[model samples]
Target chain A: MGTRKIVIEPVTRVEGHGKVTILLDEAGQVSQARLHIVEFRGFERFIQGRPYWEIPVLVQRLCGICPVSHHLAAAKAMDGIVGVDRLTPTAEKMRRLMHYGQMFQSHALHFFHLVSPDLLFGFDADPLERNVIGVARKYPELAVQGVMMRKYGQEIIKATAGKKIHGTGAIPGGINKNLSIAERDGFLKEIDQMLAWCRTSLTIARDYTLEHLDELADFGSFDSNHVSLVRADGAMDLYHGNLRAIDKDGNRIFDQVDYQGYFKYIAEEVKPWSYMKFPFISSLGPETGWYRVGPLARINACDFIDTPEAEVARKDFLSVTDGQPNNITMAYHWARMVELLHAGEKIRELLHDPDLQGGDLVLKGERRGESVGLIEAPRGTLFHHYKVDENDQVTMANLIVSTTNNNTPMNRAVEGVARKYLSGAEITEGLLNRVEVAIRAYDPCLSCATHAMGRMPLVVELHDAAGRTLDRRVRD
Target chain B: MSDSVTITIDGRNIEARPGQTILEAADAAGIYIPRLCSHPDLKPIGSCRVCTVVVDGRPQAACVKPVMDGMVVQNSTPELLQHRRNIVDMMFVEGNHFCMFCEKSGNCELQAMAYRFGITAPQYPFQFPEKEVDASHPDILLDHNRCIMCARCVRASQELDGKNVFQSIGRGFARKIGVNGERALGDTDMAATDKAADICPVGCIVRKRVGFEKPIGQRLYDTRPIGSDIEEVRA
Candidate 1:
């Protein structure tokens, strides 16, 4: 056979619009593979000239799955506009509580709704029976628990922020509302169930990983720097903390640094094929600087998790490795579940804090011209930087979302899967699914990836050397 | 003048008081007529025409049209709804209503109306009119791009705040809500606490000191589509 091509036009089971293309040489050998993000919404450009204060709410439209991250991140950036370096304890606690809610809900959504079907039913299971509803059909109890688990997290967000999707709770210096005793008690009553389900889900996720250890251990595996935010004591911190990056050799590339200095370490690369920009560490250069983010990267970069239950799970997740940064791509699902457990534990801990119900929500401050905000979104590290005029109107804005940070890695994983499983034989639907499974491991929010919009349909296409259509597959 | 009158709207008989507009009667009867520039607290202006309904086989602005005894009105008919959706689509195209990048988005009445009408995209061509933003005021911002010429602010300032600080400038496509005769908001006596500042049906006028104080998916419209409350009230 002459050189051929295979294209997965809309990678299924991911958050938004994306595709993977594999090119073969004259010998029918893998020559190049790339994952292209086909969607674009020019949020950064359009947000210019908008009032700086409106950013937190305006940017949430970027992605429905992880709007809280954008909300919190944008608010933090505006904190500099108000000239407040740190928020009051009460304000900080409320924001942290909201952040934990976001983390739990997003992770629950990914693990239960997005990835569980693939793991539980096997990657090559009947496509129609390989969805959240399918998982519900096979394991109705787990399905119900999953829905409730996500709902529990959403309810916490609604109670704190005012509503679940795009509540205007977090302001520049602080928040608009504090947790009421009644509201706190409402969540407190459900904390036990939340924790129990989280633990159960974590166990299932671990077993799933072990059952598929051989394939997962080597599937889409590659060495790269891992990045995330860590608390002062080196524990995993999702809401607020310093940026940390660990190299493939398991050495700290950067540790506990203010996110304001991110420009010094990170730079973005743009390509013609995709509107999504490729971000990399400045020191390592483009190819080497492409580090991974999100759950897997977060777990690898942190020394230990703060929550006791999650710390045990974290140890088990890291056991398969020889003390090096875990490079196995499929382990992201496991790391995500561990974080979900930690989120539930953290929510329980914060609810008991007296400061959560305190009256001091906003702190007055002067205005500054520019600022940067950074947070570990459920997907990974998210950055929002803005420059305002003296009138506090945003003159310039830039955002580096979590999915963009992992863009290079996602492409690399696609390349690896294609080269391994697709080089020589007739491409089967099952083989194409393996490639998509690798991409799903990242749980990328492509909507947020481009600061965009989309029940996106997934399609795969095959072509001959002459670009003649060979085969195509689509999933509505 | 009779105290009460009966009218049939959407095939349902409802009571209406004399001097009440069709919209007012609809509100009392638990029927929601989609509208802009119309607020219970403000006098009905009938500028947006979103609530246009067929009364006795004639199109009328429900907010201004008086309820009548034995009147046959069409509120939920396919023709009326399609016309309403077109009016909304025109508003979207005429102004730069960038809901994806707007602050008042989820809570915005215009956006909620669009969602309620299932307006995925406006059928009209986007003008992409270049609009200006007035950020001179420390506590408020007036973005001309998102304005729909609703005149809610004009009535709000003149009638409610008694400030009379806002007025409509020009006519036709060039018309816009001006702050104190085209002066900046800070140059006028309009305070952030003024009713005019809060009465904007679109994202045009917004308080500057706070943003995203609420989380996403939990805003007023996020919880339920606009006009849902009226339906609930009817129930």
Candidate 2:
């Protein structure tokens, strides 16, 4: 009685290509499972020798889904290169608007287009019916809201960044453009409607999580460290802040450390099996240091939400776990909605501010040779570091994307789900779906994480103890 | 006015100076013959045949072809438009032009010309040739990846700056703009204010620490076509 292997390649409903392998022992009990990010794109190498100013626009090629995150993060790093510690008010506000717009749209997209099908219809539902189109056919109103909400956020980005594709909004030291009065007015007209829709989506997620708390509590859930950016006073700050990492009980492992010195506190570990790298706290090393990021992690690590509406929502979310970190993987959806509401509130506040229309757009100071930029992207914290030559050519680049940060946690979630759901030698559709549900909770962008390319179809393969294929199932 | 010569361009009668080339005559008459190498202050070099025009029955480089009295020239015909577009397309593929991230993006004449010609993407396959970036100069950078070998900088260095700092070296595929000094641009007498440093039509030669100074919509040729200034004269 040797072990058998079950493989799910190109996990569906996620941003990029990933594979899940569940190993079963002689008793048909799950022994191990891993989420393998298979694609390898040498983006960091491609960025070498490029002019420092081009990085903000160049790094956007990493992921189309979260180009804004890369754009802003690279811009922040380049700002340090240009020797500017702080941007002008107008520039800061404009970039914040652009970032919140990105957060709003990205979170909305993950919830509606990617995760809603699974939530609306149980995870065991037919594969064909578990998609956005299926949602449109059965839940037309929700589908319409998702599309409109995503579009609204995109429109804000276009107005701020100057276009939907390859936006050049953020630049070194500051943003390239200011929010015009007309642009502000345009968003103002739709703010109320967007806010209403945000509430509705939050209600759906909150209700769903609360209704199935007991079931989801044990479903792919685990206790782990959480990392995110927090304002100096410990409020959740997506755009800019110092680093904060907390353990599962919400105790601060590290607090208020400048991200510029992140390499001192955080380190990345590499394994032969996957293209993605596992990130963990340097002090705790590889095993206990690994942490979660994105919505669930941010929700747990922050002392409070800065916005009014989102503050209330955060309290309710915290009450569910008795003011402790909620480690339930499925709670990611609810956490995401709370963030969505915060982004909306922040957007409305920024739009009404006079600073957005200010004239000064950039500030310059003494330049530096090396710098790091960090931002809490929709999925998680994104890091961009670079070393520039005196001639302004980029000599080195290192990126730790959000998905890559969650590498270990995703594998752990896969293993947890596989152990609980997998049974017998024959592969079942229900088991395959559960594994995906766990991975999708993280909203991992395999493409961005691995810098991969090409088509990704969910493929599940069953192999006997001898490593020979017994049965295979594919969903494209 | 007395030395002006009359020419028929695109079926329209236009007056030109006796020594002016077709491109010069077209410029004086508010008609635009698109060009890359030809500049107002530099001597015309008849390279980068983007300004090719049919003089009478044969095609000629508008930048070098003198305007003869009663000369007939075809400028913006359908065939000529496609020919110019093809030339621009070749320039796009010949170099690794990452227009999206290039500092000279909206302000680059080569990029503006492509926009004017309605080119969403280059028709030819991208060469993606290995290129060198020379950033030895303190205030300027020379990225060979964006060079189209139009000789604007070469002519400007020789005729305008009077420094002879830049010269074309090698031939055909191996051709590149070589600095006067043996090593790098830092050793050369080239200054940031040199006419050659500001004459490149692409991102080949750009000032350091000043990229993306102007926002997108406010950049040159953002709201209008490349030759809108000359075309606006007609209106």
Candidate 3:
């Protein structure tokens, strides 16, 4: 028999489109497998020559799910162009509040809507039964609580920033509006419930992991470098902080460095197969420099969470790693819940602060021509760099998104799972699911990284000798 | 009483004052006729046909067509609504409207109308036309790409500001808003605070030193959909 290939099209339930192809050698043994991203969006090319002020709103179209992250990052970058080191207390708090809402909603979306079915049901359950609708039908209370939690977070975003998606609360120097007493009191009523639900979600995650400990660890776990932003005291910080990265052995690869010298530490390598760029630590080079970002990386890299309840939960989580980095990819769900609870507490803290309602919202200044804005988005560390002329027109722009940072690790996880599960010429549905589950663990936002202007349906084709298409599947 | 006349619009009987255009009558009655170029303060210029309504079995520009007594008008008919959507789609394609990148996005009447119509994507092919940005103005910037050629700024400049700083040049696809006969807006007496500067319905005319101040979501349309003010009053 000639070489055989199996392809799965339109990997479902993740943020964007992806496909997996596994190649079988003549002996019907799995040889090579790849997860290919099919779209390319050159935002960097189109954004050039636009006025610097518009970058904040322009870059937000990158991803509908996480527009707030891009919106805040771009606005922060513009702060440098306008020549401000820090915004006023009121401005800072308002932005932090907005960011907390973003994190809470995004994490809630992933947990309750996207991944909970797999954790609740078996991974090989009926495909139709492993969806949000099924979760609602099976566990009505959990579904309702998740929906309410997401709604509460969204209301905060709407009240504070404006609308939930692509809100324009953050500007170059500061924000336009202040949080009113009424809005504060309104959110205050929900804080207790939000916090409770978040904690319950955390407990659920813990139960899931403990119940499936060995399988979770061996599923997609791998050793790689981890990167995230942290406060000076080594607390988990998403909005404002310095870059910190740790190697697989929990060694400090880089610590407390400003991201302006990012090129000196991080470099991106491009492959022709995908539009997503592979970023790594420059010194170590591509082969071994690949690192993971997002919740797992953030939890591993941080000394402790600043929030009280989350801090207590953190110690329990660290016991799993024995103070070393936890490389199990499934732990991202657990780490995400921990951060969700922290974000709930953070939102409550910021909302009650008197400084948040202050009148000083903006700081006008001179132009600086160049600046870099780096923050930890829900997916991972996001970087937005801009170079403007004296007229404040953008001459150059570079964005390193979270999913791009996790690309190498995601690919590695795909390979690991495929190698572990695939055995013969016949590709079983259960084995295919294992490969997809590996990718879903990272929760990669392929849409954000690709920034595709238009969309096409996901298509997978099987090829034989002379590259003739034998079987094809398409998902719209 | 003699100046008032009654007309049927979308099967609803509404009073119309004599000599008032169909759009003006509909507006006074709290019925929003989708319009782009016909501002209440400005004289009706039927440049944009977004407010086309079927009158007595024929389509007419509501902003310019006078309301006749006992006139049967169809504004929200399925066919008329589709026609209006097409006009809005044409306007979007005629200009380089990157609503994603536009500063006037949330506040833009054009974008809001598109939203009201539930236009996720324009059905027509995008015409990526080459346009110019006249940033020579120290106080204001004019982006030709976003101009729908509605001439609101032209009317605001001539009739309100008393300075003809803006005018329309060329015709057809080549037609564009000009800064005082091809001269830059900076060379003219157009101040940043002038009504003409604020008259643009799109991101064509932007005031310098004041951008994204209101933030996107808190802007005019973000709080509520366009025409909500008029529609809600009657509701």
Q: CA shift at B83, candidate 1, in angstroms?
A: 9.4
Per-candidate Cα RMSD to the true structure, in Å, reads 5.1, 1.9, 4.3
Predicted model with the maximum TM-score: 2
- Clashing residue pairs in candidate 3 are none
The list of candidate 2 runs beyond 4 A from truth reads A1-3, A451-457
Q: Evaluated on chain B only, what are the TM-scores of all the candidate structures, in order?
A: 0.97, 0.97, 0.96
Clashes of each: 17, 0, 0
Residues A360-391, model 3: lDDT tens digits: 99997878989999989999999999998765
Give the CA lDDT, 0 to 100, for residue B191 in model 3: 85
lDDT of each: 0.86, 0.90, 0.85
| Per-residue lDDT of model 1, residues A1-476, tens digit only | 66677777778888988777788877767788888777768889888877887788788888788788998999899888899998999888888898999999989988889889888988788888988999999899999998999898898888777778877778889988888899888888999998999989999999988888898887988899998988888999888889898898779988988888899999999887777889998988897989999999999999899899999989988887866678889989898999999999999999999998788878868888989999999999999999999777899888999999998999899899888988875677788888889999999888788754322335666678788878777664
Scored by Cα lDDT, where does model 2 land?
A: 0.90
**Predicted complexes: DockQ each:** 0.41, 0.67, 0.42
Model 2 residue pairs with clashes: none
TM-score per candidate, chains pooled: 0.83, 0.97, 0.87
Q: Candidate 1 vs candidate 3: which has greater lDDT? A: 1
Interface RMSD of each: 3.5, 1.2, 2.1
Best by DockQ: 2
DockQ-based ranking: 2, 3, 1
lDDT of 1 by residue, B81-190 (tens): 99999999999999988775576877899999999999998888999988899888878888899999888889989899998888898888998877784568878998
